[model samples]
Target: MAASLCYMNPTMIVTTSHRSSAELWRQAEEWAQRIGARAVRRQGSLAHLCELHEADGVLTITNDRLVYREPASGLEYFFHPGMAKVRIHNIEVGRGDPMIGAMQLRPGDGLLDCTVGRASDAVVAAYVAGPQGHILGLEKVPVIAQLTIHGLATYEDSSRKVTQLLRRIEVVQADYNDYLPACADDSFDTVYFDPVFHEPVEKSEPMKPLRELADKATVTAGALQQALRVARRSVVIKQRYGTPLWDQLGITQVLSSRSSRIEYGIAEP
Candidate 1:
């Protein structure tokens, strides 16, 4: 459930902030080269820069964070823990998380996140899995992957425990469809997918930008088969409550949250 790299979009360009220093400029150029995109000097507003370069969007590297701006939508995407921090706090207070419950995660467990858009769920999973556990997230889009990689490495939460959990996650730029087949059977304790919901959640403002950038592909039968094979404990898929996806995938065991509209469909290998 991932798209091709951002470099696949020829209209994308990388640039430094308007007031960037020499080191930041150099870093921007390096990132541009790594992503196979043009590195342009910041001349004016992000929209003006996009217009000048005839690009769809601009990825601006600043001292604080990496920001991607889509001129048409005026949507800026940057990496933030978002709800993962809140979810982790809830867990710390004895208020359990639905995803943790669905996975029945244990210390030392390994989790493979198939569609790790922004990696909020992955962070939460890593926290529950503890120091002995390992979390690997797969994101096909190069820009999203890079943003997440940088954020997980650099972002520091007020809680040192949260920061440690974030650092434990490893982000890889690869589509799950291709990555899954390469992994050996029973390689991970749990394989998870959180594809962009077929029906959007109106109140999810943060998700709007992600949905625009992320691959919209639904979980395919073949991919589910691979997930089941690769998972030793369970494969959990996040979808809207009453989604036809569960029936379509022949998933009968599902965990629901009374307060939320989402459900986790679970299948054992």
Candidate 2:
């Protein structure tokens, strides 16, 4: 079967800024058209939008970028590579980053990020991969993908390298399950998966939104097999340190941060 576009609730209307220029409104309208959401003027409150459509959330477009706000939950989620603190810290530290160690990346290695999440890893991977390398990110959820894409596009950072790396990653809305099998053998230097772990680590507020929104598919042996077929060097899976994925996938080599709760399972050909 072909990959399906993940669903976004139609009740969530796209609202624009009150002082938005004509050009800005046009762009916002285009965004609404693409996402299949109605474009409306911002009224008294965002809560009004929720009541107007009886929606769970509202997607707002300002001069800066696109943002999704769920009033009831008070959860706001958007992606900006510059804002990925942990990944940035890892990059700053240079050598002991577990993800960098797991991928074993060279200067020009191409990577496939099967579960992009906030594209944090993908951004770091792209930085490691260099300008010559390419990265493709697959996100199964439409709303998440769009939000991420918008953030990637609009976020401005002082560091030109980080900005360039963010632009280099191509985020597509498609399930990796459907996309992987179609790839030719050794299509990318590394195929990376970061499925929702069976165990939860210490809770962080930023991660809560991801846990709620991300695809909760269990990674199986079959999934690893497909990833292995696509990876020229190795297939890596990131999860909680003690998850069953290590045993299930026969991943004996686990590289982890001494201080962090996460680990990476490497399956090489």
Candidate 3:
């Protein structure tokens, strides 16, 4: 199905700055138009929807409110909707396997995924946290943002297993900067940053897709700096064996996720 889009009350807004909330929404709306996301319906304050693309889900501009709704659980999440050419990674392990990220989670932990991308990790984080915990996702690409929200929307009607899992998940289409400040200080126990995976190539640099989209994340830095500051416990940085999450964001230890490159970061105690 084609993705849908909406104005979420068409907030009292103005094009204040180059990248203000309204302006971002306007640009995002234009992109959504180019694609085919439609307005689904008005559920309370939010315009809930379905049929979203991956890029649509990543470019949201929320005005601080999280549009929390009841969740239903028994559904399998949908990741990467329309991308055709799947280039195989040299590593045997797939990047989206939730088990690889187990170390980044703890029972009852409130976790946030800043660089959500297609949001495979967000679904895993929510399931890992279980019932007592909460999962919040932030994506900034219009197509990806729509797809992610559609996943979250499906949770609203999940059966037994799905209901249990969906109860803890909250997904939104806002910039990390807007979302982070809205949360109280120390709101999360852990924050996860998987700054895309890059491997060496003989020619002069990296591979294609990862080399491209990995560099597009804005939330990674904001998520790292602010996620650490607002986290009550610590932050988890996911990177390939040799790649670093810059200088300031370092972990005390690592866990090999049964993959050659994908590694987990456990903050120092």
**What pairs collide in candidate 1?**
none
Residue 21, model 3, lDDT: 55
Per-model root-mean-square deviation over C-alphas:
2.2, 2.9, 13.6
* Candidate whose TM-score is highest: 1
Compared with the true structure, what per-residue lDDT tens digits does model 3 show for residues 160-248? 44434543566676666666767777888776665545454334132332233233432244455666677777667666665565444
**Model 2 lDDT tens row, 1-269:** 22233433435678887777788778778877766677787776888778877777777888776787788778777775634555766667774467878899877999999999878888888877888999999988677788777667766667777777788888887788888998999999999998876566765555767666676776778778899999999999998866777887788988876467788989997
Better of 1 and 3 by TM-score: 1
Error of 1 at 66 (Å): 1.4
Residue 237, candidate 3: C-alpha displacement in angstroms: 1.4
List the candidates' TM-scores in order.
0.94, 0.87, 0.52
Give the Å error, residue 165, model 3.
Answer: 3.0
Give me the runs in candidate 1 sitting further than 4 Å from their true place.
1-10
TM-score of structure candidate 1 = 0.94
Please tell me which model should have the higher lDDT, number 1 or number 2.
1
Writing each residue's lDDT as its tens digit, candidate 1 over 1-269 gives 33333324436899998788899989999888766678999998888998998988889898877888898888788888879989988988999899999999988999999988788999999988888999999987777888888889999888898789889999998889899999999999999999989798777888888788877778888899999999999999999887999888999999987568889999999
